[model samples]
Target chain A: MATSTPTPDTPAGPTPTEARHRRIGELFWSSDPNELRPWEERFTLSATLLLLLLLLGSPATVPTTLLAVTGLVARDLLHRTWFWMAVAATFPLGLLRMSWLAWDNHHFLLLYWIVAIAITRLAAEPDEQLRRSARLLLGLTFLFATLWKLGTPDFRSGEFFAYLTVSDPRIANVLVALGLQDGTVVPTLAAELRQLEPGADAALPIAPGVWRVAELLAWATIAVEGAIAALYLAPLTSRWRWLRDAALVAFVLVTYPVAPVSGFGWLLVSMGLMATSLTGRRRTTLYLGAFLAIAVFTERNAVRNAIEQVLSLLPGVG
Target chain B: MGAIGRFTGLVAPLALVLVAVLQVWGVTQHDLSQWKGGGFGMFSTVDANANRVLDVRLVTEEGAFPLTPAELVGVAPQGTGRFVSGTLTLPTDDRLDRIAELAERSAWYLDEQGAATSDPSSASPQLEVQAVEVTVYRPVPDRADQRLRFEPIAHRRLESPA
Candidate 1:
């Protein structure tokens, strides 16, 4: 290829802002589709896809839906700060219209992440801004969750999980299959609970083993969450940085199967993907695999069901 | 950077602080459930909608009777879920008033068999409601007897429209 010589009137090369814009454009509009992009570019693409999935999975009010659809139809708008700003602005309004109390924690997380993306896009160093925001957001999320659990008497006493194990069918199923609870106990307790009068002092019988199991689960949950929080919040050292990704991925893999909060799991994975570097192909693949796995887990309950099936095959098991 | 850009950079941090403050305010000032309002407190507490009990009743000259699931659906086809969930989270007067309004608007009445119906000409006796009462209760676990006791957190009563 023949290169054109720069004339006296021409500047030496692309200015810094032009180069930055070019890099951003190349991220979204690559000449070769298979060409590898930077981690920030990959994160932008992944997060956009995740946001679209969330919006479609739970359609917001008319304005929010229309704005999101507009962005989806015009893929080029995904990189624009104004597009995200409009979306973020309408997100909370949609939540308010639906009644904020009705929204789950993950819904709020989605809103914050959307706002974070919009704000970061406006920074001079968008990539660095995005990475820092993701790290802080993820760390704060786990930190607050842990602190809340620690502060709550019911949660700390293991009574919360004990009660949930009986009330929530998803958790009950896994606990039942694992021999932590009697299969017939939950149904019996549920029927009795339905008949209870308001303001009544009632004692529903529970299997002793369930309390023990709940205590174990409670501690394990705290340990895992606390570990992840500490790892993400700590100053990153080259040697220990890998632990953050490992802890996050492990949390997703282990928690989502039983918890069935696929939206939360997906959001966590998206944040993790954003914070991680693209130093290794394997790391990128792991994040992609995790994101897909969460979808599969949500749609099919594959991992939970598989565990149940395997346990049932054992002698004396359900 | 422009002024807008600098302000935009603060959005994420500011949002985090706002969420935390609101979450705590909700728990302390209002009786908002800890499981909600976006403090990232999911799976941290049992004080969620599932543990909240709504005691809804229709009061007539005949006396007060609890509203059955069917009656609730009949009275507020669209608003029932929203009202219940809202009351569970905040249990504010506004939500209670909405529930009262829905209960007054209900055309269905309890027949002689205690079943809900909209037909006034039915042979069975009809219970005409003069008022609506709603009480929201939350579960408190008792370790002494392995009991989950429901204590009333909020209550509201409104006379039905003439």
Candidate 2:
């Protein structure tokens, strides 16, 4: 309950606006050990950490690398408007140079989030602006994703996941362990698919069992993504508001482990963290856990390995 | 909030709209993959890089020879991989021109095996590239067989400078 009123020593003391600015600056830049940091401050730190992780993980283009090193050296620079403007500006420049060749969809997500954070820093009510922006962006992301999946015939027919299971080694391992396809089928199918000439009338054989599992996965993905989108876009006063955090956290936990794109997962969690109520300790803890979970998932196939270990313990399974 | 702050607040939402519009435009007009350019279409479609291929060939006075991986690496040493990737993602006229320009500017020679080489010392016969042809192929599932086939979605050919 801090007041923005000027004190009796107003002649010598800073004006209310200056005082407020200093307080906001302290919220971001201060490193006092004893001072209790609020959730907003903590959110900013988490976002900065997420940005640093992105810059480090991405191709070491000059601008991104320089931004990463500078932010690391002077951590406080992350709080500055000019610094974020440079950051927000760097992404488009990178996109122009790299174009579609190298950038993933999540790179665009990262850019949007960075832009939101940059704009938030310039606002009088940064926390409010950030929350609104985060919710809107997250909602739009899933909406577009769901729409794309629905529009694409391949996705609806489960061809995408079926092909991915046989092709992508990471996904193939998981599916193979789940008994969707025998271990031998992956390499053989993949080889045949690779060797098949473009526009050739030849079709690769897919086991009926694998096709069913892929269809199930495709539908499940749609359901979950659609649910998350609906929940995030729901009105603030609606009963659905409380469930947004749970849905997002669950999405992160379930999606990142198998997919293993931790940068995208981390960015989602950061946005979820921003959108949630700061007053709830449990919500904050849940987000922090999600962050750590993404790190663990990215560092190694912890969840997949653990699943495999469990499957090995089961009878007639390995 | 001041006017600038208010305007700044709108930037994120406006950008979201702009991205969605551009992504759709790309998908419909340029045959840009759904999974790229801020569409959030990742994991939604198999139409990504894995399903796309770029076939580049250098048409010389004698015959058309496939541009070897080595030649591609040699031409744009710094950005060869990305250049190839960019062409596959969205094979616009500009990107094709750039690729053709790179090939035309660099000197190519044929070795004893008649394979093109960028090195002068390996030259058995000097070769002049007449044009560069780049075709972008994408996998499209055949309805009858349910098997994926590569179809040439876009093709670009640029004549070399005299």
- Runs in model 1 with CA error above 4 Å? A1-37, A60-77, A89-97, A301-318, B2-10, B59-62, B104-110, B113-131, B159-162
Poorest 10 consecutive residues by lDDT, candidate 2 chain A: A28-37
Give the poorly placed runs of model 2, Cα more than 4 Å off.
A1-42, A48-97, A189-203, A301-318, B3-8, B58-64, B75-77, B100-132, B142-146, B158-162
TM-score of 2: 0.77
Pairs that clash in candidate 2? A198-B150, A199-B150
Best by TM-score: 1
Residue-level lDDT tens digits of model 2 in A1-318: 243345686545567776665566555435431243455555555665566666745543688668867876676676678987887777677666665546787777777888888888888877667778888888888888998888888888888887777667778787677766667766786677656544453454566777778788889989889988888777767455768888889989888777868778888887887787644346556877888888787867566788789999999996
C-alpha lDDT of candidate 1 relative to the true structure? 0.74
True contacts kept of each: 0.69, 0.64
The docking category that best describes candidate 1 is medium
Candidate-wise lDDT, in order: 0.74, 0.74
Note each model's CA RMSD in angstroms.
Answer: 7.4, 8.3
Candidate 2 CAPRI grade = acceptable
A5-44, model 1: which lDDT tens digit per residue?
A: 5789865665677556556555543432224357545655
What 10-residue stretch in candidate 1 chain A is worst by lDDT? Answer: A27-36
